[model samples]
Target: MAKDRYAPKTLDDLMANMSSRMSSYVGKSQQLNQHQELLTQCVGATMAQKCRISNYRDSILVIEAESAAVAMRLNYMKMSILSDLRKNGLADLCQIKIQTSPRAAADQQAQKKRSEPIHNSRILSQQTADALLEVAEHAPASLKTKLEKLAALSKKNK
Candidate 1:
């Protein structure tokens, strides 16, 4: 009888095999990093909570403010923000643009093209689908993140 060559007979052997397959991705270029940072900072600005960053390019960043007031303020403050980003080395590779309307309107339209059942995506991952169904059995409205809280509250009442 031949020995099972594929099986890891011990935990250390399994860990060693996994470690041999590992690789690193530590460094990124300054230009790409700067553009990403610019996008992030623009999204973190005061007006950004009511806004969304949805368009980016090698030299442009476009955002959509949720309100007219925010849009106006962002437009007025654009140059200052751009200067700040340049000073911080972000705008060196990225320019800023603020729009009052949604940049993701096209994305919303694409999503509208999706007319399949809501559960179509759920079925894509069988494990997640089963988990969601199992959770639904307990409380249809209870979210997974809220499960522990609900259980704790129930225990306290008992």
Candidate 2:
């Protein structure tokens, strides 16, 4: 019997094969993430959410802000941020660069849209309102009053 050349391989096997080729890229990504987290901690949650670490090279740290206002704010804190980074393990970091990127704002907006819950304003059907009224008649006084209010509100929607 001949071996199948097009057999499916396990994910682990594929990852193991690719690990050597991707190791440096993965390491660099992790380092950047760590730097980003450190920056967030230094700047506070609100400011951090508006900017991101774009790159770090030759002792220069590049940051991309969602807008010019954010970039200006980052520039104001550059010295403090630089010292903080140095104290936190990035001792060789020499300069901080802030750039405004409109695309960052768009990306943030898209993320907000994805995270926000979609609300569908659905009107109650006559059948449901009638059922609610029927139940309200037998419910306790407090619940009956609430149920009656709900049924009445549903009718107003129509």
Candidate 3:
């Protein structure tokens, strides 16, 4: 045979056969990129030396900052970032993940574990007191007193 003109020959022709699906994919990609930019702005609130957007795919924005300190600082601002993402209506297609390459996400997970309440109690118990001690160990001065009182109150309630 000399040629089969009807055979699928090019990417454009292949896409032409499925324009509806391709258009939706393109639209979603565009929406995701726009939301990623908006969430990227929240990075500046943390005093990050430089915030760069390395990738915006699958609704996850991977950010690279100039330093670990900056990344660590940004960690405390995650909820604010997430709120901004939601307030601006970008939450539907966007999420923020702070990436400091030297420290793995494991570090973040550990930090989160440290930050969150290790135990849930209707009323605080001795175990909760230990959790309070754990929190007080690293709590900032401004928060220490309030947290202490909370721990005390929870303990008394136990």
Candidate 4:
């Protein structure tokens, strides 16, 4: 008996069909990748690392920079970047846009947090607790609560 043509196929078969359908898109994707690499090379390592090609469409390349300062700097290099892209055969790359994105800043903050040594909730030493208790007597009520908490933490640990 012949298999039903409209029936769903195995995962591999489905993926293969989808891949074939997307073949045309692959060329444009490669061109975009090339444009990004070329842009990086033209701009130099330091600035390029902070900027990335966010979109490419209709002769415009939208670049996302880490901050407004970087975006402004890239804006100044817009013409130079366009000339370099044109030279490399991407003549359609006529306009360059620089946009400040908070994503990079957030990622940097997250990375810093990850790399930082975590502070363990420390129990105060007996000597330190005694000192806090002594100081708390003369301390204003506002400071007393904090000192008492530390003294209590030290006692609990004993």
Candidate 5:
């Protein structure tokens, strides 16, 4: 029988062949890392801390922000960031896209803590109900309607 020359004969040979086959993927990963490093340098440490380069595709650099407010702020810096990327040899970078991701775990937990409803009580005293009604009388029409509803609900609870 003829020797199967293409078949790897050892684990090291197989690993070498596999790495060669994956070279393109490794190169692409390196390019992505370079782009991310460039972006971080361009945007500076503070702004970069709030966002990351999520992808670069079809000449667009997609950035992921921690929140919509941060995205908005990044949007304002899009042009400058693009220019900086080009200057740093990322001439293919033509546009900047800022996408908002959900808050990180710590930020979400802090928000939850801040928004937690008071557990003391939902019940309202007669005096508090009367106070709401009195405030409603002096409030603007729009606010008055809402306050009146609250006062009515408070009275019903009592």
Candidate 6:
């Protein structure tokens, strides 16, 4: 049996064998994440939750704020944020760009909606229940049972 030089022994070895471009992209992603953390710390918890570092390229940091209000606030504090980022090792940092992203706020709202418990508060009225019972009387045995069960819900509701 011949040993395969290209065969990776473990996940770490496989990752280590990744192309230079992929490695560079991963490094850049990690660096951006670190910058995001530093930015959040500089902005404070309240404002940090409303905005995020979207990109860092050409010495310009792009910040995506959830709303216009947040964007305006970030715009007002841009110079301070730039200085803070510079102090935190982004010495080449030149400008801070703030963009209002309604989509981000919409996404958060959708997530909140998904997390909330759905409430079905609809109740069968007595008149509707009576109509169902009347129909159930002439219905086939199988359908009659289901209609009766549905009509019974009104009594339970009352």
RMSD after CA superposition, every candidate: 17.3, 9.2, 19.6, 7.2, 12.9, 5.8
Q: What digit string (tens of lDDT, one per residue) describes model 4 on residues 50-141?
A: 88787888888888899999898988888888898899878767788888997976786699899999987776799998899999999999
Worst 10 residues of 5 by lDDT: 102-111
Residue-level lDDT of model 3, residues 78-143, one tens digit each, is 778768867777555367787766444456557779999876457767777778868987989878
Q: Which 10-residue span in candidate 6 carries the lowest summed lDDT?
A: 12-21
Model 5 C-alpha lDDT per residue in residues 1-158, reported as the tens digit of each score: 99999876998978998998799778878888888889889889888878877778899888888888889988998899999999998987778888988656357558788999858566877788789999999999999999888878876775
TM-score, cand. 4 = 0.55
Ranking the candidates on lDDT from highest down gives 2, 6, 4, 5, 3, 1
What ordering of candidates by TM-score runs from best to worst?
A: 2, 6, 4, 5, 3, 1
After TM-score superposition, what is the CA distance of residue 67 in candidate 5 from its true location, in Å?
1.2
lDDT of 1 by residue, 36-66 (tens): 4564575364444556655556767676775
Could you give candidate 6's per-residue lDDT for residues 22-128 as a string of tens digits? 98989889988998899988999889978888899999999999999899989889989989989988999998889999898788789999999999899999999
How much lDDT does each candidate structure score? 0.59, 0.93, 0.68, 0.85, 0.84, 0.91
Q: Considering every candidate listed, which one attains the maximal lDDT?
A: 2
Q: Supply the TM-score for candidate 1.
A: 0.37
**lDDT of model 2 at residue 64?**
97
The worst-scoring run of ten residues by lDDT in candidate 3 lies at: 45-54
The candidate, 4 or 6, that scores higher on TM-score is 6
State which candidate, 3 or 4, has the greater lDDT: 4
**CA deviation > 4 Å runs, candidate 2:** 1-18, 121-158
The digit string of per-residue lDDT tens for model 2 on 26-133 reads 988999999999999899999998999989999999999998999999999999999999999899999999999989889889999999999869888888889999
Greater lDDT among 1 and 6 belongs to 6
C-alpha RMSD between model 2 and the true structure: 9.2
Worst 10 residues of 2 by lDDT: 149-158
Best by TM-score: 2
